[model samples]
Target chain A: MTSGPADAGEAMGSAARAPTGGMPPSRDRGAPTEKGTATPPPGTGQAAVGAPVITDVAGLQTVIDTLAGQGYTVIGPTRRGSAIVLAEIGGTQDLPQGCGDSQDAGTYRVTDRRDEAFFGFAATPQSWKAFLFPSRELLWSGAAAPGRLTVTPDPAPGKPMAFLGVRSCDLHAIYIQDRVLLGRAYTDPRYAARRADAFIIAVGCSDPSSTCFCVSMGTGPAPSAGFDLSLTELLRDGRHRFVARAGSERGAAVLACLTAPTAGPDDLSAAQAVTDTAAAHMGRHLDTRGIRDLLYASADHPRWDDAASRCLSCTNCTLVCPTCFCASLETVPDLTGEHLTRQRVWDSCFTSGHSHLSAGSVHGTTRSRYRQWLTHKLASWVDQFGTSGCVGCGRCITWCPAAIDITQEAAALRVPAPHDPAPGGEPA
Target chain B: MRKLAVWKFASCDGCQLTLLNCEDDLLPLTDQVEIAYFPQATRAVAAGPYDLSLVDGSITTPADAERIRQVRAVSRRLVSIGACATAGGIQALRNFSDIGDFSSAVYARPEYIDTLATSTPVAAHVPVDFELNGCPIDKDQLLTVITAFLRDSKPDIPSHSVCVECKQRGTVCVMVADGIPCMGPVTHAGCGAICPSYGRGCYSCFGPQDTLNTRSLAGRFAFLGMPEPAVARTFRTFYAAAPPFATESSMHSGGGR
Candidate 1:
């Protein structure tokens, strides 16, 4: 958490400038290595971060414990209710062991993975957004002082977080957030602080849900770039192993501490097949070809009304979405108006407050609200953020009360609207 | 100092008690505003021409109808608080049935009981400046409205569905996750999604949210294998007098408790 200025600047550079998931290795160097905290490698410049290593279940725990020993609070997915939710972890036992989930539109089932595979699950209900861009944050606070009022920005939290068992789609989502929060002209200092102190242990998807469309989104099935260390779980021939690759210099240092060997040829191919199977078995598809133009042009389509008829105007899709970063500030004053706090809470386009003005809410109808969300995610976001907002993790599809699939809606909008003839003229 | 009055027409007094339940803020709030006409709490009944009047309960009698008009005349601002004041509440279920039958069943002497044919919201009788909806209004929300009125500004009360608050609370959708028939999709927020957090379905305690798809949620309830009458009863709970829930509840007839 308390890295030197060089390491902090380099860590910020990796995620800030990295294009999409193309996160380059941000080498941490000469940071006064305390308690085995990624012992600064030989050269300051990039060098061999070691080859991919194969580790057993116990080695996985060693990696986790080592990260913790380095003053990083490790967070991982664990079984909570019928869902796998992210929470703080002490060791491997906190992970959702021998558990897998089956998810469809408006339906979910947590089934047994049958084997003792630790990372056998899909994207959790709670994304990494909660850890980074929290639901509610106190940006600043004001108190009445003698003669004048003083306001101070809330300092970012001090915990250095290490996330274990992160997926490829989620990694891409983090990259997207990095672009939104850090790469901008005016950086959110709080988000920058959290993102800089974060380490990701990306896990390849062995069990994807029916709602998953990361293949079409060009983000997932396997971890490619955005992580420090990428792990692929192998459960074959009564062998339980993880083919782990260090993506950053810190990852190599962590791997050196573990009881793992250099990955053999057999281990590499077995890991490839695991991702290949997951890729082929993807249940949904989204055709992203000219999607921005299609949604922008189809604003007046009757399909919006049809969708609104079945829609509940609930904010689930926006809240569950990893990339949907819309927030509103609420001013809270004390009884005598001497003390006040301004909180930034997650806001959705679906809410009437999102479109509020001096007169009233601009988008009063459910159709308009739904349109704003859909168009922003697919079309308008391209103009503002230079990329489509959706990473296609499919939390919206899985969590929607009405089961309104974004992919299906996008496909429905792709169909050309028929032209209407003049009132008294012959039908065209 | 501004004067504040708490009025009751035909409520459980739970909404009035919510003001008293503001234990921490109550003493501080009293310093700023005079508790003028709170007959329930204080014996010292200060006269009206009140700065603010919080009207609770529905207008169920002709005398209450006359009294609300008088309360509206004296108060600078009238805020109808709770479901009874905003919607006719659970008592408004009698609006669907004959009052003659209800009168004979409840009262020993039917002729002595002089009541209106239907229970109606306070807004139905007088022009209410604001309506705070909930079975018993949330303490924080009530305080917000009071503070907003004191500041002469609009209160930050959102009219979005309970599902929004439920999802924000990180509670898994009971309908989507557990196949429970919940009214969160159509009911107004402000309850902090209490029902779903405890694994129980919302009973529409805060009435309908703005632009809610009642028909869609009702259909979802039906798809979850809930009986047609059970679907109707779900919409007919705390705020049945609200037009949206009332209209949706009326679609399914017969078999009821």
Candidate 2:
């Protein structure tokens, strides 16, 4: 691959303007349109595959503005309650450009970066899941009245959203949700409608959160998959810039409307270096060796009783989990019984009311409830989903009022194989 | 008539809320099973001699002990819900320490409080037909168990550990990614590993499964730098008085019951 100003212009000329039939690029930050352009072929950003790199925030704004002009809502991070939360943004001014977050157990605070850098840091409390799956949503609404039981579907996907600064782990979380909600067993039309029409603009993390364990889960410091466009923030000669690469065709079309610099070997390698650093600096680690047998064999071990004693039985941990798919539904009726609407809400196993059947009875004890929750998360979910149910994001530990850390608990039970020494030379 | 009743003794109203939280499925479930005495859902209370009963909370008082026996006598098939009904619950913390002093330490009116010296599950005083494991059972699992029982099929809830659910969900082992403590390996599976699934560690809400090996798990927690007493104290939480958990917690403290 040759790197020169002349070649850069040629590449820029060829990559500009989308080559398909969907919503055209917008002119500002606003709501996205229902329609979207056809995606560019895959491998658009690969060196051998000709990936384009964008270098200016202002230039990036031009592309965002173009999309907004075409009637699309651009959503990203905005300041809220001392932290930058993912929300709807109107322009670059609305973004937390030079700010990052500090996350620890039960503590999340926003801090200023000395340099004015965009996309300078890592994981935040907010993940893309909040937008795609709001806390409360109406699944179906209908009349319970005679001769009329019509169920209304969820609202149409909000004006095609353009997620401006999604992280890799959050993006993967969205995909995981997709599999759960829109799998072979059943399809969630509302989820599909919103997801299909959305645009993803991902930013590669330079500084991972101390609470982040995405590297161990292979989620990433740099996005490897599931993004339309990916970005890397760089600093040179006191200048702040973003190196944007097209992951899909829609990404390439957006690039066409902006001014982008052809990335050199140094730019690409620096990006790689940042990702490697984040991976190596993981704040925590888990020892999974022989975990299955150890947990299975240790079922009657004395540990359950010890753990049950301290557990407050609050559902704080569940509320913060990214992949917890458990949900319950309820129907509320309006006066006169004219209409009934079904609402879906998150439910947790840590509560006392979840187990009731018919008569005034329950199964298991508090011990049983605690044991069931832990066992299912670590072992049984594998049988059901063909994969462990956790992504090791550490949100549960950070937000837990009781400060319970699942990684330490699992490590405690692990009886290492003869070959493996205990992780960190000590149990959790 | 198919009579149904929802009962509580000493627990947070979490399990009953689970039924209420059963958005679309709740009405359909109510159509099949009578909602006779769920105070959380309806003010219309039905007297029991019930065909089926779903009991929540624990027997923390003398009155609770007697009420449980009566509840068992009337119900054809009685099920216990949440950790409180199945184990002693967090209040079972009383089982380990000096109840008198402990109560006085926390309460301003300890003299007025009429709590039992020990918190116990309903099954301790009366026979239970089924046990739904969870601090609050997975509403889906609860539904599955009920629907299956009505149809004469064994409820297909997993008897395995939270580790199994974690693997099935493709969640990376939290113990590996974050050097945090977790109880997912030995805990039962009703919360669908909610805590771990959300990038957090598991706080066993669903109690012990059919078979549990808690000793080795305790060893692991110790290895992770949790002191022995802390380890024992952790086990004594929500299900403190249950046999397996209680016995294990006591043993961890080297204070045999």
Candidate 3:
């Protein structure tokens, strides 16, 4: 076994002296591209630029430790009160190493991972949204007296928050939120500042969770883009190493500080193979080709009334969704009728007051409310935003007190795709 | 001297809260209409012969039956508020199960509570100028209906199903892509289809649309693998007393006529 500073220095020097300016080779010369970096199509998953070859577990710790020294607030997965939460990490010792989690409707719990790998599983119950757009934040405050008014906008500053092991699905979630909050015609300055300042160093998932449907959403088992840097862990001799790649200038700068080697073909191929294995083993599956037509055709369908009966008209699903954007304004007056403050808060269609009118009338019954929610998420969302409002996150299914699963509902209404040719039809 | 009164019985104060919920709209509305007898908002209970009475909730007791008839005689125009007023609210779940068993199971002293074997809608006993659907009606639409009635114009509440509203909003089909169940096609259009936009299914809080095809939709529900009992149970909630939904659910129940 190698010992002391000279051996460590030699390891760094060997990586530095590799022949290739980019990725290093670690595999057979005659191997096919299947043994090389597996490239999925664009918008699916992409390999990170300048992928680094991580040989063993010690190499993984070296990269993580180097980043902590460079003034970045490194956050990674850790067990937090029955759930796996992303929290501040001091070093590799702080990771939920060799631990995995079980997630389902209204429940989430972590278990022993068997292998002490850093990022080996699918989505956790907690989403990245908890950090970006918190449940409650004071947008602005104001006090009025005799037209002498004082207003102060809430201070929303962007800190250098570095995410150590983000999943591909969550990366897509961030993109969805980007469109909702930052990319919209009216930008949310608070959300924008928070997102722009944050740096993502993702760890591609080698295993998918039972609740995961990222493959259907075309999100992923591995992060293709959006992150500044990505890693894939390879365990050998009880030491876990990572296949690292830079996605931006910032990522390149971060990579420069670490003692990672140029990625050989063996490391790249192994990472690709790991990502493929994860993709092939997705826990959930969806067939969406003819779903639109099925719903449209079944309009005036009896299923509406049938499903609505058990629904409690509670708004739990909307509250937990990453893409739901409906909100309303409420104005309250002080003791004197002279002054009032208007505030906007989350509103759900299920709440009885949501539809109450001046004539003292409510519009839609529980059945209609349930129907509206399902149709809008499945059918109408496509017509308006050109994107499904749902990210296939399964949060709504799990959080519903009634135990309603949207996936099951879709499967029950299957219809043949209109465009699919007959068995004997020739190619167009 | 046009009189306008607000009334409530047998329901959560949600519909009444809506009037108060109208922040900027409340001042203008009060300026236009007389605040005659709204017990929830003010202590004022002006005498009857009121021009308009906005009634909330259903008649579930013998006393309520007497009160509605008297209120009807005193007011020229009576508009029912929320599902409780128009469709009997969640209490309408009693329409499916025997009221005797339900009452006995829920209350420790069943005799103490004022008794009615069945919960009936406002339109059942008294004449109603309009019956807005939903657990609570859409505020702007309710305001529009009020102003329109005052102007002698027909209220512009759409008789269209939730499907049209979904089309207008351009939301994706959750049923199609995610296999989510939805009731939008047969349910009345209102509330802008809020639930689905937030990645959830509609629960049909606005009730049935005109020209509903429950038989065919039920076939689809069966196709989706929903059991007969489960489907029947769902239809018997919220607006369970409404004719189309009520009748369809009865057909699935063993006791149905």
Q: Which candidate leads in TM-score?
A: 1
lDDT-better candidate, 2 vs 3: 2
Candidate 2 per-residue lDDT over residues A67-88, each given as its tens digit: 6876778988776544566678
lDDT of 3: 0.63
The pairs that clash in candidate 1 are none
Model 3 residue runs over 4 Å out of place are A1-47, A53-73, A105-107, A328-363, A415-428, B1-257
The residue-level lDDT of candidate 1 at A117 comes to 86
DockQ of each: 0.65, 0.04, 0.04
> All models: lDDT?
0.80, 0.64, 0.63
Top-DockQ candidate index: 1
The parts of candidate 2 lying over 4 Å away from their true place are A1-49, A290-294, A359-370, A415-428, B1-257
Note the clash tally of each candidate. 0, 169, 74
In terms of lDDT, which candidate is strongest?
1
* Interface Cα RMSD, each model: 1.2, 12.5, 13.0
- Model 3 C-alpha lDDT per residue in residues B1-257, reported as the tens digit of each score: 46778889788878888878878888777766777989989996778788878898988999999999998998988999888899888887776667778768999998887768778899989889988877788887777666665655556565555644553343443443234566665677688889777767677888887635565455546655678876676666677788887887877845254
Q: Poorest 10 consecutive residues of model 3 chain A by lDDT? A: A1-10
Residue-by-residue lDDT tens digits, candidate 2, B6-96: 8888888898898788898777777777778877778997776788799999888878888888888888889888888888788887777
The per-residue C-alpha lDDT of model 2 at residue A50 equals: 40
lDDT of 2 at A29: 23
